[model samples]
Target: MDLEPPLSYGHGICRPRGFAKDPLVKTVPAIEALHPEMTEWRRDFHRHPELSFEETRTAGLVAQRLRDFGLDPVEGIGKTGVAAVIDSGKPGPSLALRADMDALPMDDRGGKDWHSHTAGVAHTCGHDGHTAALLGVARHLAAHPPASGRVVLIFQPAEENGLGARAMIDDGLLDRFPFDEVYAFHNMPLLAPGQAGVRTGPTLNGYIVWEIAVEGVGGHGAAFFKATDPLQAAARLAAEISSIVGRYLDPAESGLITVCSLQAGHSHNVIPAHATLSGTMRALKPEVMELLYQRLETACRGVAELTGCTIACKRLAEVPPCVNAPEGADRAAAACAEVLGEGAVIRDHPPFPFTDDFALFLEAAPGAYLFLGQESAMCHNPAYDFDDALLPVAASIFTTLVRQRLGYAGTHARSVAPPST
Candidate 1:
C-alpha cells in the first residue's frame, strides 16, 4: 500500500532496534489500514442493538474478535462484559483502556439500510463506534506492541442504566486485573467529525435515578372530601421536587431535576390508592447530589402530610461524577492534539451535563474521559448513529496514550498485512 512519511511534528512511531526501521509511525495509517474491517463490525453491531446487562451476543462477538487478534479475552466479568490484557513482556505501569458495550432502550428511525432490527433498542449513543474503536486498537496493538507495559481493554456492560462500570468494579475488575490508570471516550454531536475535546476537572456530572410512590385512601371521585387523593399528593410532590434544584441549590452551581414520568389511576372516575413519580437528579459534585436527595425526601414528607398520604422513595441507580487527574487529563488532551491537530482539540472545554458510568473507573485509578466529535443528531436521539470514519481517529487516540505512558523507545512491534479492500 502507498503511504506518506509519518508526521514528525511531535514524534509518531519509534523504530525498534531489532527490525529494520520502516518509516510508518503515525497511528492514522496503521488504524486507517484496518478501518474497512472495523466499519463492517460497527455496522453489524448497529443493526442489532442490545440493552444493559443483556449484551450476551455483543459480548460474545467482542471476545471472539479479541481471540482472533490473539488476546485471550475473559467474558462475563460483570455480567456480559468482557476484558483482556496485552502484556509487553516487560516492566511498566499498567493502564486500563475501556469502551462501554450496550445500547439505549430506544429505536432509531433514521433512513439507513443498517438500522437496528431490535424493536425499541438502538445505538443512539454511538457505543457501536466506541466498541469498534477499541477493537481496532486491539488489532493495531497486537501487530504493534508497545515498548513495555500492560494495557487492559475493558468492554463494560450496562452503562446506559449507570451500573455497568460499578458492577464491573464490584465484580473485582480492579483487584483481578490491576491497572495504574484508565481512559475512555464518547462521541459528541454537532462538531466536525474527529474533532476532540477534554475537560481537566469535573468532566461530567453525578446523577441519581429515583422513583417515589404515594399511597392513600381510594374512593369514588364523587366522594369529594371523603377520600385521601394520592394522585393529588403525587402532583404536589412533583412540583415541590422540581423547586429543589432552583430554590434550595445555588443558582451559580449546576443542578437539574427532571421529572421523567408520573403514573396514577387508570380510571378517570375513581381515586387510585397509589401514584408514582420518577425522574433523575444531576449535579457537578457528589455532595450536591446528597443535598438534593435530602431535599427531595423532605418535600415528599411535607406533601404526604398535606394530603394525608404515605410516601416512599427508592433510588434505582446512581452514577458518580467523572473527575479526571490533572496530569492524566493533560496527556489525553495532548494525544487528541496528536491525532486531530492542535487547533482541532479543546482543553478546558465546558463540562458535559450528562453522567457517565465510566466515573467508577476513575475512583479506582487516575484516568480521563474525552469527547470525539461527530456532526450528527444529538446522542440519545432515535436518529443518531455513530460516524464510522472516526474509528481510526479514536484508535489513534487510544494507542497514543498507551505509547505516551509506556515511554516510546525502540521495541519489537509485530507487523500485520493491511486489508486488501
Candidate 2:
C-alpha cells in the first residue's frame, strides 16, 4: 500500500519504450490514433474558451464525442455539464472519472500556434488538457469496456469558479451515475513530464471567497474631525482580519487569509463614503475554514463599529478540501507504479493551496485525485500546455487501474456486477 518510492529527476525510469512494450500500451493505439483528433479538439476548445456555466459549445462537443464513442451521453445535468455512461456486459461496481471543462477570464500569452482566439478568455488553467485526457480515456474505455463494472465519464463545467462540482452534485449526479469510486487527474507543471504524484488524503486546501463592504460618512479630507473615512475602516478591517489567522487559527492547521483587492474613494482629497474589500480564505480543514469565516465576520463588524462605519460581508464561493480515500490512493499508487515503474512515482508531497471542485465527487464516493507531471508552465499561466507525450502513459495508467480494480486483462473486458440500486 506504500507507493511513496524515492524519485530522481531526469532519471527516465518510465520511458515511452516500456509503455509501448506493455500489453496495456497496445490498447492505447486507438487513443494514439486519435491523438491528432484530440489535439484538434483541444485547440478548438482553446480557441473558443467559455466561462463558467456558459459552455454551450464545449458541452455540445463533449456530448458529440461521447455519442461517437458509442455511449449514452447526458447533458445539462449541472448547467452545461455532460456525463456519459459506458456499461459493461456483466455486473460489478461502478466507477466515475471526471474532468473540468471551463476556461479562465484571461488572455493567452503562451504564444503557441494554437493559442486562444477568444479575447479575455483562455484555458490558462489547462482544463482543455483535462478534457482531452478524459476524452482519451472515454475512447479507450468505449473500445475496451471493463469486465465487471460501469464507468461514468464526467465533463464538468465551472471548475475555475469552484462551483461546477457542487452544481453537479446538486443536480443529482451521484444519484444518477451512482459510482462506487471516482477518480480525477490534473496536470502539474511543478513536476517533470510523465511523473505522477499522489497523496493519501487532503491533497488541496479548502477555499472560500468573501466580499466585505464598509460604509461611512464622506467629507473633505482637510476636515479630519468631520468625516468617518471608509478607507480607514477598510484598512483596519484588512489588518485585523489578517491578524485573526495568525492569532486565532491553530498553529498546526495551515490557513491563510489574503485581502486581494481594496476599492475606495475616487477623489484624493475627499473621504470616501464606501469602500470594498474582496479576497479569499484558505485552510486545510472544514473546521478551520468555518472558524476563519466566523473570525472574519466578527473582525469586520468590530472594525466597522470601532470606526463608526457600517459593514457587510458576503460569502462568494466555498469549495471543500480534496481528501483522497486511503483505498483509492493505494490503488492509484499501485497502478501508477505498474505503468510508470516504482521509481518514477512520487507519493509524498505537501498539499497545495489550490482548490478543486473534484473534492465534491470525492465527498460523495471513495475516490482519489491525482496530479500528473506535464513539464509545462504552471497552471493559471497562459504559457501552460499539457504535455501531449504523457498521453499514452496516462492512458496506460487509467487502463491499468481499471484492469486491476476489475480483475480483467486486455481490451474489451465486460461487466460483472449489477448497477447500484
Instruction: Give the number of the best model, judged by lDDT.
Output: 1
lDDT of 2 by residue, 180-287 (tens): 998888876666555678889898887899999898999999995899889999999988987998899878888889899999989878988999999999877888
lDDT of 1 at 307: 87
lDDT of 1 at 119: 90
Name the regions of candidate 2 deviating beyond 4 angstroms.
1-30, 409-421
Cα RMSD to the true fold for all candidates: 7.9, 6.1
Backbone clash pairs for candidate 1 read: none
